[model samples]
Target: MPTKTDEERVPNFGYAGFRLDAPDASVAWNLQRGRSGQNATGDALPHNPTAQTPRRGAPPPPLRVSNPKVLNYLDDRCRVHKETINLCKSVLQRKSIDWISVQRNDMSNPIHDVDLVISVGGDGTLLRASHFLNSSIPVLGVNSDPTCPDEVDELTDEFDARRSTGHLCAATAANFEQILDATLDGSRQPSELSRISVKLNGLQLPTYALNDILVSHPCPASVSRFSFRKRSNTGESSHLINCRSSGLRVATPAGSTAAMLSAGGFVMPISSHELQYMIREPISPRDADKPLLHGLVKQGQHILVVWYNEEGAVYFDGSHVMHSIQHGDTLEISSDAPILKVILPENLLKQGS
Candidate 1:
């Protein structure tokens, strides 16, 4: 029998909490609509700038109904999320394990020293943690609020929408202890998922995307303009093609089933190293031949995009972290990024297999 390597052991644990656990998050969420009502001038402004402005003396519009049932449902979800974290903590305490906890927003805290990272939320939590990890560390996602089977038949769509899908999470509060024990005892092996590397103006970005990157205008309503070309592994180059669209997305195989799939991109196998690209809502001249709107970027190949929009931005793993792209800035996406080691559930592993 072979001995377990250091990578296979879980000596130190790093736990990551999600948004709802952050300080004042619930309060902010409750006040979000009120905050958006008026600017500093106290004038009632239309939610859409283009909409007709109300008279200065007119009474403010009636507040939308604060659905009590929906509010209770959301509150219960938050409670479940917090309780799940508490349960995990209790287990760690009972076992006398060494661990450290950090909020998802706390990027300054170093989590690299841990042998295994645990995300106590949904896929979003795991994705955020992945930004801070290297290929050496393995991460386990714990779904804090998984939907119950009974709720599916009884709950309304609005209530159902509040539950965490936990697509990337292998464990929920119900099975966390068992899964963690198996992981610590080396009974489970981690899966290596490829990531997407990005470069801006020839300099590599500090953050690698475990999911996908969205490049678009700063304003969602504005069109995105850019020119892209592919450089193959053999040094062959494709002609630069211009595009006008809502945005462009480059996704890893791990991310292909996400926004890429929703955007009409094919879902690649989880083990694939290739990256997929898709242009969103492209605009073509009348009778003009359609340019390369979507394609795969194989390993060792790179895609270079030159920004043509005056104010554009690149979003990583969602809308959380973004960087401005000035006109003429060059953005490059490649498969040369580091791989992420993830502990998938038995079902997910079987699916990937």
Candidate 2:
């Protein structure tokens, strides 16, 4: 609390009484709690990309402790547990791990970084591994179904339409599974949302997720047209909203409290807030169930977005493979990564232990 008008600066190389103030509060978004905030608690990531190519001079020491791989992105949709894949591959072959082979058909060859990604399946295979490892990487789902529609569910014996609603939240985050068993027993700790970069078309997609970022319209119901954007402290906003009905969302805060709280949208909790991922519009389940008519869009807000699509498909986590958005393309979304490096399973944090 210092002042001369309070002084302001953030330039680095050293440090100095840095300062900033002028924001009181306006960050409560829920487009369905923005895609369920990435189940077991903590999803929606991607704003921490500043270490890309810096260091023409010096600075290099702490970067060699890597070894994590047992990713099984649904291996033909589901069925993993040969003793948990040989005890997580014997701890990555005695800690010399290097995995990759959970193919839908293996086009495989698109990884930027990885230190931990052992998703087995369910919760849409961990949002297709946070839509293809955007904030570099950090994942561990392992719920080959034992009731795992939520929280490593273990009731599976067979029969599905999408059963296993005894959730702790995986796909829909149905409930947050006691914070995913306190984040695998480290005791509740998923609050790392702030890294996001999906400005499709002019290409700024340095992706990262926790659960929420979709733009569908492969119409089985129709009403698909799109647009809606906002950037603030109190400055940029755009619009053209239409989304022919039931398909359009952008969520984070571990997904606005889970699929934005089941598509009614709004459930932000896990603090420090300033959410983005609310360019919503979902109207064509003929018109009223519209938002789940699969969540469509088009309301307006743009510095760029010339979209025109002939029909839906902008997935990112249904299993990363984006390359089908037309009419002039531009789908930029922003919130940016801060920090998230989790490896839970010590006690999943602990509060009911």
Candidate 3:
């Protein structure tokens, strides 16, 4: 793995995340797993394609995305994506950074040799890229569609119709060059974002969620039944609850503003080391007392959930990774994952604080 001490380490740039083809359609993302069959050249090749012939002088950088045409729906976003790529090309030409083009689905692609990773889309892009990178490599997010108007015409309008990801993204395509310059010059410090790790049946999973994890019946309309307990530092079960609800969510502070917030969960400050759990639409029987539905999971507290639904599943970061659960299976969640280093403009870093 390339570290800060390696002089040959170069910045790696990529674009990922979900694409909204139309205002009325539900947003979707690439869900492919492991080493992708597609190469950085956007061709059907192996993970490391050495035979890809660069065209002429200054060959275009590797770009990986399923259906790049999805950007065509929004003229501004399409332009932003193109402009960001052009800016990256210019920087690559002027600097020693190495260009990395990868598909959103290639989570096991080789990127450990990279010094920094630049995600060129929204929050989803950064989230996907995090799975493919080493913890030591900091990530920089570029908000491609920052021009979306601040005000929405209708309260019921879809969130995507109004703003594109200005909240989660730190740099705009227009000023990314300046931010990159400062980052390379050592004038900027990266923000450290905490992540959540999950274990199934006492074995660790391959991925972690930077946002939140959803545990529920695989069928959306079905009810989920589970019992969970908080294991204290002394190895004793401190808090326990039996839940009958739509699902449950475990989130980090950085993920508080995402799905958890939409489900009536509170937002934690970006720097919080604490984790939170919430039950979704719990059901109370006529004679039984309702279990505690929501609460904070302190820094070292461990949450263990026993599955009662025969066909339940656990979704990490909104389905980026899904693990099937069977009756009596136990899933553990904690704040023990690697700390993610996210690059941000110094000014925005202060604003986050």
Cα lDDT listed for each candidate: 0.72, 0.39, 0.66
148-210: candidate 2 lDDT, tens digit per residue: 354234322322213222122221122223433344456544434443346676566555555
Of 1 and 3, the candidate ahead on lDDT is 1
- lDDT tens digits by residue: candidate 3, 137-196: 777777765544543444224323343464556677678778777777878668888888
Candidate 3, poorest ten consecutive residues by summed lDDT:
19-28
Which regions of candidate 1 fall more than 4 Å away from where they truly are?
1-65, 148-160, 285-291
Task: Estimate the TM-score of every prediction.
Answer: 0.80, 0.25, 0.74
lDDT order, best first, reads 1, 3, 2
Clashing pairs in 1: none
Model 3 whole-model lDDT (C-alpha atoms): 0.66
Clash count in backbone of candidate 3: 0
Cα shift from native, residue 170, model 2 (Å): 13
Best by lDDT: 1
Query: How many clashing pairs in candidate 2?
Result: 88
